[model samples]
Target: MGDLKILICVLIFSIKTVHSTKSKPHIVIIIADDLGWNDVGFHGSNQIPTPNMDALAYNGVILNRFYTLPQCTPSRAALLTGQYPMRYGYQGIPILAGENRFLPFQIPTLAKKLKELGYDTHLIGKWHLGQGYRNATPGAHGFDNHFGYWNGFMGYFNHEATGGNMVGLDMHHNDEPVWDTRGQYATDLITEKSEEVIKGHNESKPLFLIVSHLAVHTGKGGVDLEVKDIAENNKKFGYIQDERRRMYAGMTDELDKSVGDTIKALAEKRILDNTIIVFFSDNGAPTIGSALLDNTGSNWPLRGQKFTVFDGGVRTVAMIYSEQLQNKGTINNELIHITDLMPTLYYAAGGDVASLGKIDGINQWLTITKSEKSQRSEALINIDEARNVSALLTDGGRYKLINGSTVFSEVDGDFYGETGRDDSNPEYNTDDILHSSVNILLRGNLTQEKILNLRKQMELKSCRKSTIDHDSCRYNSVCLFDLFEDPCETTNIANKFPEVTERMKSKLEKYWSEVKVQRKGFLDPNANPVYYNNTWYPWLEDTRCHVGDLRTILLS
Candidate 1:
């Protein structure tokens, strides 16, 4: 015990901390659903204007190599638990609506850890982790308050979700069905709710809020895309010819509004200077010709789409904005995975990172704030035995290996997006997209010219086009590439680098062997909302415990 205490002190004082606030730094995580690499303005997309997101990125450490699981559930599981979802087996795929899978209650979540330090934890939208069993809900996982749907995606206005045609109203405030706010756009409601939480927060206790948004994700059924003020959106995005893409632009615009509004609320509460706002997409966009949920967001210049292990799917747009960092307004190309969030934020909130027992995440608090070397080297992109696919990012992200490719890989492997928008790809140069607000929002340390040069220096440099054969790969195939030179993943070097490929394959096998839990989500008739008062509610009995005989004593 004495040794542990001394070690904790050593770790705490080993490097300079971000800030020493009167209160613990407020932690806010803003998630964008199915937002693609090319979807945001910061990522060099001119098709849509994301001035607010760009402004925040310009001010913060723009994450040049942020990696996530190529799907929703696994990525989220990693972030919350600080462990790869594969250990307890939620990594293979997303929980389809009405599926009986949930992250095991035994695993302590990020909210639970923060709660241990007296944080007021709240989840404002999209709790897709679990819903069938009460023990699997957000309340059971440690969030003090949860407001939103339990399904993967829902109608922005109606809030009706569908899982293989099992459709019903999904909006809920805690465990109860909510109906009063029907016909309201989800983006507006989500933004409003987040602002309300910030405004109403006691502030005596540090705030740990997760604004898990539903924006930019395709909504339910045929009316999949919902935007607030479509008439106004059409005029704003009339330049983009595709109707669906135009609607998507409007949805993305709404998402930016959420980001801007949340930051404003934090500033208004006098916590902006002491707040750490983490923003990133849960996964890459499901572009046209992708395997599932074909939303119109683009991952152009990055090969493949959602669910594929290519850079487009796993390598996502991410940034960390905080007034705490001394190193500001530059891109950090360190190897960072979604799982790192747990220890990173927990440490930032003053929790002992050493006490976060047996997690896959590496503590990067000092690295990000001080521009030191990242603690992680290799990252498991994904290992889904169900999909018969797996991938690994190894050699400090210099090499990548993908085995058992999905059928849609060939189709999605091609760089996808409207060519008209690609003329002045933001990667080409930063002449047009820089908003004037960047200088003001950047905490005043960096001049506009210095910030621009930093942006250029850290930008993802485009390589000479490699010929990508669309018809070559079929069904499943093992492919390897040197990711340092090939971020787009156009060439497969598996044969050229046999030794590297085998080593990575061995690493993946070890992780798969460590997995002790696996759950598959399947359609069920009983899960339909008609049986549960026309709303999705818990139906399964709690599987959190087993029956045991009571202890007894007999007197002579």
Candidate 2:
């Protein structure tokens, strides 16, 4: 009788524990800025040690086929609204600081969607959506609190951004400039703030937190490579010969620690067991010679850099961690887009996907957690009419149709390295980066055996150079590649596979026809930070003239 009672009690407790932790898991996303494909340890980059990210990735599921826009702002917009940036005219170029352009007020962000479900939502860093108007701020976008910059790139120490040829303070605690912490390093500051938020959260309500870090992304102007503690940073990355690369390595290390620290906070708070954590870069690194922000991170063996439609710019290092996942520590090659995040996480939070309305995103919760077949078959990479640049992904992403010059001149079609065109010894020098997931739960030979099998089955050949000429690619031309065969997109197969190119073109046209073109925002003179006590603020709010007129001008 006593044994029977004890067994019943144990079973009841187990059921309760499972239900509490798995059903209403806290959703967290850590967004790394301008991180390269080969920047992570799991991606086989021995240059920078990212053990924290590696440990989490090894414990979780690594997203092998994740895709995003070639730029940060558009990707962020896609993530927030669960729709293609082309729908709102954000496909062309990122939102420039001091521009009147912003995300349309009609669309609800991921924060808003979760907030509707009674989650305590917060955005801890980098709100690049637009902050010209109060309505466009993160607070108006559904975050209960916003502690970060509004522009694209800013100084890591000073928290100042140079836009419209003028530099000004950009950090904020909601709408006000965070002047007091001017000299502080943004990576450390952002991490501390995230830890603070997590520690203080009420466990009764599910938390939706986005830590959009500024680490690994080069800062504005002269202070390009921002390191937290110079002495400590130098000591760790002493093996790196070049000063620039060494600085970048240090920045990456800080980001790795940030990840560990954040996970630690959650564990300490006892919410980690019930938390669903997703981490990925906003876009690929710029590398040495790329005209896109001139960062020092490397995307070696993957052609092109940031602001290009190539895999180096689109595909990112990504992973998801959760105790609730049925198959942890695996690689998922699902056809996922940045837009998928909103619906995927919404469904994970027990919200109805139907409530999200007619967004372009498909709910990928099951595809991620249960290892179910990817429900999505195609993704519209982008249709940037402004830059006359675009690319279309089709046939379940086995093929990609490129319609514009992927800014290949800067990235050099066929020329690639950590040193850009130098073609020196590159990182991840292997022919392919094998899908990097080894279930650490297995012991000894089983782990090694599984790793070997995984390497063979999931190997992806990232070509170093191409036979095709790219002179035509410098103009508005077409290129098609079977991404499965040539993941680096070296060979332009438009002529060889004319029918496939035509089909992909037709699919792109359909999406292009449906685009609701967004007007580019002009640099408002009033937006000069010099006007607002040398701090970046919503200058339009203070204007006595008609706000409608400015918006109408932009629309016209």
Candidate 3:
């Protein structure tokens, strides 16, 4: 009897200890579609209301210099894999049905790692990284539960493709169709499902829910006079209409409310205090002159909008609400990229993330929790071939970078300057399109002396023979500039401060080469076709019939 009692006591103590140590906090990542820095109240927007997001920022750490890949799919890919989009195959947006480009299976994701550590992974919203039909589906990647669309954008009223039906593009609730229903908005549906996911969870384990909403992207062509009329009289028509701006603003308002509802649900369940809620945009706003939505989202006082490498195209608003870190109402200007989220989450959970494998993102928990200004010393930014851009050491709130392609040495990639806007692209009015309030510095500033020294530094840290090879790569080294001094990217100080540019360029090259070696590309050659045969996918399924035959449906 005595021996049995002792054994029981030991077992009870072990059980208690395990429960205490394994009390991992829940994590919620909320990503808005094509949202801009000036679109939210947290960033001083008086036109559109975003109370929930404002509260999140007010009670958390607002990352003033947060960045993301310039495009949607690429940003998602980078955030998921903790690597540059180019390293993987998802460099641009995927529109075709059954596209196979996705983050490699070998690359560990936040969902996969958290699940392995006994957490319930739920993805509730847009999964544009890849279609849900192919091996690109969220379920195949690492998410245990996925309820959203498989493509870039979808209609708000009907869950169908933005305008009409598109094959394999129906709204889904985990490999199942969300039956066609009227009076249901896509944003509300996403929020509803997200709330359900949080409420329905039985708490068998810790949770990691991603509430990725598709609101504020394209407001169904910005119709609906009540919503569209808000922007009255074509207020500064650089690219879009006033009505369209109003419609987009309305969408943002709804998105904010949706976030509020979700937050309310978490608090109702008493999980708000223990959970870490992260809110950020996937990428910059779409800058196409005719696109109704992007024109409405003024990135304001920043350079460029969407698709370009300028600050507006890549820079975004990011905030984290967590009680453990005691991060509230503080603005952090330290340079941090989207890739850093995965590793930071891992560290926050207090789990052994090292054993999972090497990742490009460094754990930035200190920067968030402690409000340490000097946490991040350097960071890099890359967007396909437009620009071979990189940022070197951050010194006292000042950011220095070497911007210019290796082969396109003379070619300036400044998307936010007078030369960049006026000198190129005849189709669109570059001045009207370049809405940035800042200037950009470029190649002319880097003199021959600085260029030579930079070249020598590149020679030492050369990646010309490394694995990540690009046929279009230009000169290996270049000049450095304080973006604040020259946001237009016109000045080439390589001659004056050749040594500084050389040193920074060398650092960038070494880092790029190392990343190239580790991220072996993954490819999927499957053709899973679209859900409905319509105008977008005319080759396959089409829901509407015209003249007794299938014909293209034009959007006015």
**Index of the highest-TM-score prediction:** 1
Whole-model alpha-carbon lDDT for candidate 2:
0.77
Q: Mark the regions of model 3 whose C-alpha exceeds 4 Å error after superposition.
A: 1-22, 93-98, 132-134, 162-168, 181-183, 219-241, 288-295, 373-375, 383-397, 400-480, 484-496, 511-556
Clashes of each: 0, 0, 39
1 or 2: which has the higher TM-score? 1
lDDT, candidate 1, residue 218?
Answer: 88
- What 10-residue stretch in candidate 2 is worst by lDDT? 435-444
Candidate-wise lDDT, in order: 0.78, 0.77, 0.58
lDDT of 2 by residue, 368-428 (tens): 8889998888998877776667787887789988877564465545434453222232343
What is the C-alpha local distance difference test score of candidate 1? 0.78
- What's every prediction's RMSD, in angstroms? 9.6, 7.3, 14.9
* Highest lDDT against the true fold, candidate: 1
lDDT of 1 by residue, 162-266 (tens): 887788888988888898989999988888888989989886788999999998888866247878778898888777778888899899888887787787677
Off by over 4 Å in 2: 1-19, 407-409, 419-462, 465-468, 544-556
**Alpha-carbon deviation at 278 in model 3, angstroms:** 0.3
Clash total of candidate 2: 0
